[model samples]
Target: MTTDAQAGPITLADVRAALADTDPSRTNAGALRKVLGRGSYATIQKHLDAIRAERAPAPPEAPGAVPAPPAEALHAIWGAAWAQAQVMTLARMERLSAERDTALALAAAQAQDVAGLAAEIDAQAAAAQDLADSQAQALAAAQGVALEATARADRQAQELAAARAEIERITAAAAQAAALAEREATIERQTLQAALERQIDKYTDLKAVVDHLKPMAG
Candidate 1:
């Protein structure tokens, strides 16, 4: 927990402690900011977002569920409309051919009018084709956005996983180091005890020899 005059770097441990008593569903930016002092809403939000992102696993693909069209319902509606237009265009051509035949029996002026109507139909078809092309372009753009979102999610998952693995490795290494230190301390204690015991034995032997020599000298 490090802070400056106003705000500071919010650690993962600090965030966890702040939310320890709070309900998971109620843990929002405001709630976190209340417990974790000195950070702005954005700072709290950034830490909270990272916590959630790290905790969340990547969503699994639904089995047997078809991937949705890029444009979703809009694409389907437009596709159906385009298909209907093709059918109507064919029917309109048939009607125009019958009308042209009728005009041929009537006059040159009516035949000219039928030619105009055919031109209008061709223009409408071109407009419909243009609309379809625009929709296709829009769908492609949507697909690109979806792909980018997916890639971002995958990257986050991988980074979180790596972080967890590194933490575990550090923890295991610390435990091993601590155990080694305790063993070394125990060995040093035993060595000191053995040295002290040897000194005591030598002192006892010298005392006995000194006592025996004093009686002889006497």
Candidate 2:
């Protein structure tokens, strides 16, 4: 590397040496800037143009042909135009690279957001499932309680029916006993009346016999 501080001033020789060391396809002011380290871009370009003009094949001169005066200026102008075009190309490439990096970053961020949303949806679904399970359990418990209450009501109804049947049976038995006692009292009264009538007849017969005996004795 030939820096300006070490080489005193960036010259055509310095530009030539940098261009030789660099790949021919990548030979430009920017690449030369890294090797030379201390020249303005315009100055480096001017030296590079001079080097290209020197290497370009000169047209064969006719015998006693006069050298054109404006050819040097035209060569320098064309070299500057070419250098400007290369600089524009390099700038465009750098801009495109930066844009690609930005696009990649945005894509990564979008992926992360999608992942987070997926996780949240899964959590909500799990919560809904848990809520449904709890409601089902509560309904089952309520049904069990209702069935037990119904069973108790049925048992009470059966007991009440049995008690009513027992009351009916006792009433019927008491009615039958009262009817039998009434028949026995009527029979006893009829037998007492008959004995009284027989005694009266016996008394009458005895009085008649006594009267006949008194008359005979007189």
Candidate 3:
């Protein structure tokens, strides 16, 4: 708690006055209490009530806090206050029907404005949630697409691997066939040469027979 001595040129009355300065707009009570400084909501409200009852002009509101009443709101409040005064004054003589109606209308309008602000806040929150939901959906879709692409790539890789294996098998079979053909060609050349040598020996044997027969004839 700040004492008057600790706070230079300030007093408890200053704090009360600061609390009095706050416009009683529909704001968070907790927030207002914090702004009032070193007090509870009841304390701040007591100060406000005292200021109003004592007919003192509240101090200017804190700079850059929650927006205080605008000119229009102040005017409206003044007009309503004036109407209320007139009704109170005239109540002894006659009913202030017009003033009552105007006050009721202004009150209704203010209530509608509060309601509208609440609705707008809710709408903005809903829009934010919708945007987040859409982004989440988009992320999920992207992940799904990525997963599908990965599966497709895996399938394609498998097929390519199978194709490469088939190619290797075919190339190996062709090499084996080429080697067999070369061996067969060599065997056929050796067999033909052996047959030619045998035929030459037969021809020599036939020539001996011919020589023997000629001698016998002579």
| Candidate lDDT (C-alpha), each | 0.85, 0.83, 0.77
For model 3 the local lDDT of residue 122 reads 100
Per-residue lDDT over 13-66 for candidate 2, one digit per residue giving the tens place of the 0 to 100 score: 878888885544457788799977777888888888787777768999778876
Q: How should the candidates be ordered by lDDT, best one leading?
A: 1, 2, 3
Q: For each candidate, what TM-score against the reference?
A: 0.35, 0.44, 0.44
Q: Quick one: best lDDT, which candidate?
A: 1
lDDT value for candidate 3?
Answer: 0.77
Per-residue CA lDDT of model 3 for 107-191, tens digit only, reads 9999999999999999999999999999999999999999999999999999999999999999999999999999999999999
lDDT of 1 by residue, 1-218 (tens): 54362354766677777888665455798878777665678867777777787677799977896776677787889999999999999999999999988877788777788999999999999999999999999999999999999999999999999999999999999999999999999999999999999999999999999998998898
> What is the RMSD of candidate 1?
52.0
* Candidate 1: residue 117 Cα off by (Å): 8.7
Scored by Cα lDDT, where does model 2 land?
Answer: 0.83
Q: Give, for candidate 1, the lowest lDDT window spanning 10 residues.
A: 1-10
Give the lowest summed-lDDT range of ten residues in model 2.
21-30
Error of 3 at 188 (Å): 2.0
